[model samples]
Target: MNEALTLISFGENGWGDEIAKGVIVTVTLALATLPFGLILGFIIALAKKSQEPSLRMAANIYTTIFRGLPELLTLFLVYFGVQIGLQQLLKLMGFDVYIEVNSFVAGMVALALVFSSYASEAFLSAFRGIPQGQYEGGYALGLSHAKTMRLIVLPQLIRLALPALGNLWLILLKETSLVSVIGLSDLVRQSGIAARVTKEPFLFFGIACLIYLVLAIISSSGLSSIERWSKRGDATR
Candidate 1:
């Protein structure tokens, strides 16, 4: 037990600092991805709910393509394929420069796309649950379409979609591990490196698992609070 403790101690003899940094990266990546994912998802949901057939078709195609692709494959395409395409484009423009995609950027973009795809469905469902009278009520007060959505529709939309979005957030948190595949040095990669160097796979992996469980537990608690807060004045229980 002493040896194990020393192995993970926060010094030259241990990998505790590296693991800590990895946790930071994982958390930071998730935080950075959330707003973009949520906003894009909300936009996509609105597009799908639009009366225009072209807008609806485009939104549906976007969600279907991203949702159908495996996360890792999407990451690979963003990191490798996009980079190559950019490089080629630059070459065609006579700028002969190599454009390397940042792993963090690639991972965030891929994960955000995936998260938004799923989130749009949740938002769409929430939109459907809302009555048409909600829109009429907003307009009855002389609110513009955008203002009506921003002030009235949005609050209710968020309240209804909070639970589903919370679940997606948890999934997104776990999926941050997938970024390690592209050399992001996230929790999973850090743990993997420590395991190999120390020849204590179970120990390091177990620690990783514990860290993830703690995150999930904390997230669940926070999400529950948010859900309760959103439902606070509801007459429909």
Candidate 2:
């Protein structure tokens, strides 16, 4: 037990510092992806609900394709295919530059696409849960459509969507591990390296698992608080 502890201890003979850096990368990637994913998902939800048939069809197609594909495949496409495409485009433009997509950027894009696809469905459900009367009420108040949605509809939509979105956030957090396959040096990758070098796979991997569990627990607690706060007005009513 002493030997195991020392192996992970924070010093020259241990893997602690490297593992800590990996955790940071994992978290930073998730944070970087969140807003883009949520905003894009919200936009996709709007598109899915648009009166224009083409817009609705396009949104549906997008969600279907992304949600249907395996996430690893999506990452590969983004990491490699996107890089190739960009290189080709640049060459065509006479720039002749080689383009290599950063693993972090590629991971963020792929995960955002996947997250947004699922989030759009959740947002759509929330939109449906809202009453038509709200829109009518806003119109009656002489508010413009956009203003009504922004001022009145959005708050309720978020309240309704929060639980599902929270669940998605947890899933997104786990999915960050997938980026390690693309050489992102995230938590899982660092643990793998430590395990290999120290010849203690179970110990390092077990530590990695515990860290992930802690993150999930913390995320759940925070999300629950946000959910309750969002519904505070409803509670008063």
lDDT of 1 by residue, 109-226 (tens): 9999999999999999999989999999999999999999999889899999999999999999999999999999999999999999999999999999999999999999999998
Give a tens-digit lDDT track for model 2, residues 1-237. 999989999989999999999999999999999999999999999999999999999999999999999999999999999989988988888998877889999999999999999999999999999999999999999999999999999999999999999999999999999999999999999999999999999999999999999999999999989988998887452
Give candidate 2's TM-score. Answer: 0.97
lDDT of 2: 0.96
The residue ranges of model 2 lying beyond 4 angstroms of the native Cα positions read: none
